[model samples]
Target: MFQPTGQKRLTNVSVIRYKRGRKRFEIACYPSTVLSYRAGHLKDLSEVLQVDEVFENVSKGKVAASGDLRECFGTTDRAKIIRQILERGELQVSERERQYGLRNSLQEIANIIAAKTVSRATQRPIPVGLVYKALQEAHFSVQPTRSVKAQALEAIRLLQQHSELDLERARMRLRVHVPAQHDAKRLQERLVQIETDAAKKAKRGEVGSAAQVAAGASVRGGSDTSASLQMVQVESEEWLTGGALLWTLQIDPGWFRTLEQIVAEETHGSGTVEVISLRVLHEGDHLNDVL
Candidate 1:
């Protein structure tokens, strides 16, 4: 805490941008800095005013020698923002609460407000920019939050798009070793279901089959269901006589891991789940021969 004499009163105002580019207003007048007073007893000039309080004091013209700070911005909107703060306090939705990164502040208030408003109005996410229209309809004009909300919504859209592609690109080839005591009937049923699902997806243009590799460079081929199925023997002495199976599965990588875990758990940790190959699909690769 730095002290100033009565004749040399000093006032310092600092604006800091924090998480999600939210602004935090801090004012240090004569006694203490905004963050310093929270540390308990120190010096005479140690009482700090946080931004929310600053908003109230500044709006009322209470603090002495704050004319310059007061004149820096339009008073009309400041009164509205302060009023909204006093009325709404902070935007909070219990049902929309997440277990992680819960925040309460003015910085992301617009984003939260827009997201909630859109979700409530349409039961889905609308563009963040559109939130301004909704706010306008509600007679609430907060421009900063509108811009922040729009950016946040755009970021969310990009994340969702990337995640969908990641899921589509997670296909893999599993080389599984069957236990000697494993039931043959169950394995056949599982294989049949896998082939059926593959054919369905292929028909929908959702994936390409390795069986079409030699016929063309791309996955597009004739309606031969056999194109998605391939088998090879494991070069192990124990699996020399049809004891092992190698099959390619086109699925999200996470699903494959989950399936592997289930198999391991069911087999009392005796089953083998080996990834023979993992493919990163591109536009052309899906149509080309099996890698």
Candidate 2:
């Protein structure tokens, strides 16, 4: 005969994606089922829930005997339900629903216990065994000692310490390695060599001399007067104090012709023009600033 077998309520249910391809498909299953399958190849979890509930009620004096508890589950043997519930908790509820439902059930049980019954001389709180039984029936594992606040605080502290250490280590490793002074000296020497080679090239007419190339020292007319002469060098400290100056100039065609004539007269058939100090100066100062 069918008695008042415990009613089944679906606590949680959701569709899970099983596979995806050209054709996508999903399946609906309870988290308890998945967890149980992973833990062991056990089946028939609903029976477990019924048996646990009956056993719990009987244990709490709500039921008279094992037969009565079995009758409650509409079965002669309650062992089957008990074993199922022990092996696997509630399968009817999804993870989400089970979580909320379990909490709510606990709270309700706490309230009911608080309202009823009185204590003796000491006046202690009446324990709600039924509430605990209900949770066990629902496959909710209750820990006697669980502190959410404490766990959260511990996690936060650990994360903060780790982050601080990481930042400090990074800062310590940051360093800019400057080039050696010897390297700088070598570079300067190379530059001087390049300038000397350039000067030799200028003498061979392969390149223009510094005097001919100095800026603001271009010839004005076809005349070769002292006033029209190019300043080759400046010996004043005022010009050399800041730094060396190098520059270039473009001579007028007429001035160039006159200068060539003057040089021809002075050298008198000397096939090559000999270059002395080839520096072009402007107002007792060199033309360009060298870094």
Q: Pick the candidate with the highest lDDT.
A: 1
Can you write out model 2's per-residue Cα lDDT over 57-94, one digit (the tens) per residue? 22122332445434444564544544433434333344
Model 2, CA-based lDDT: 0.32
Per-residue accuracy of model 1 over 85-159 as CA lDDT, tens digit each: 333333222333321222222225435533332231222334444543343343342232335455444433333
TM-score of each: 0.29, 0.16
Backbone clashes, each candidate = 8, 11
Locate the minimum summed-lDDT window of 10 residues in model 1: 211-220
Which residue runs does candidate 1 get wrong by more than 4 Å? 1-167, 194-242, 246-250, 265-268, 276-278, 282-291
Candidate 1 residue pairs that clash: 31-45, 31-46, 32-45, 217-287, 217-288, 218-287, 218-288, 219-287
TM-score of model 1 relative to the true fold?
Answer: 0.29
Q: Top model by TM-score, which number? A: 1
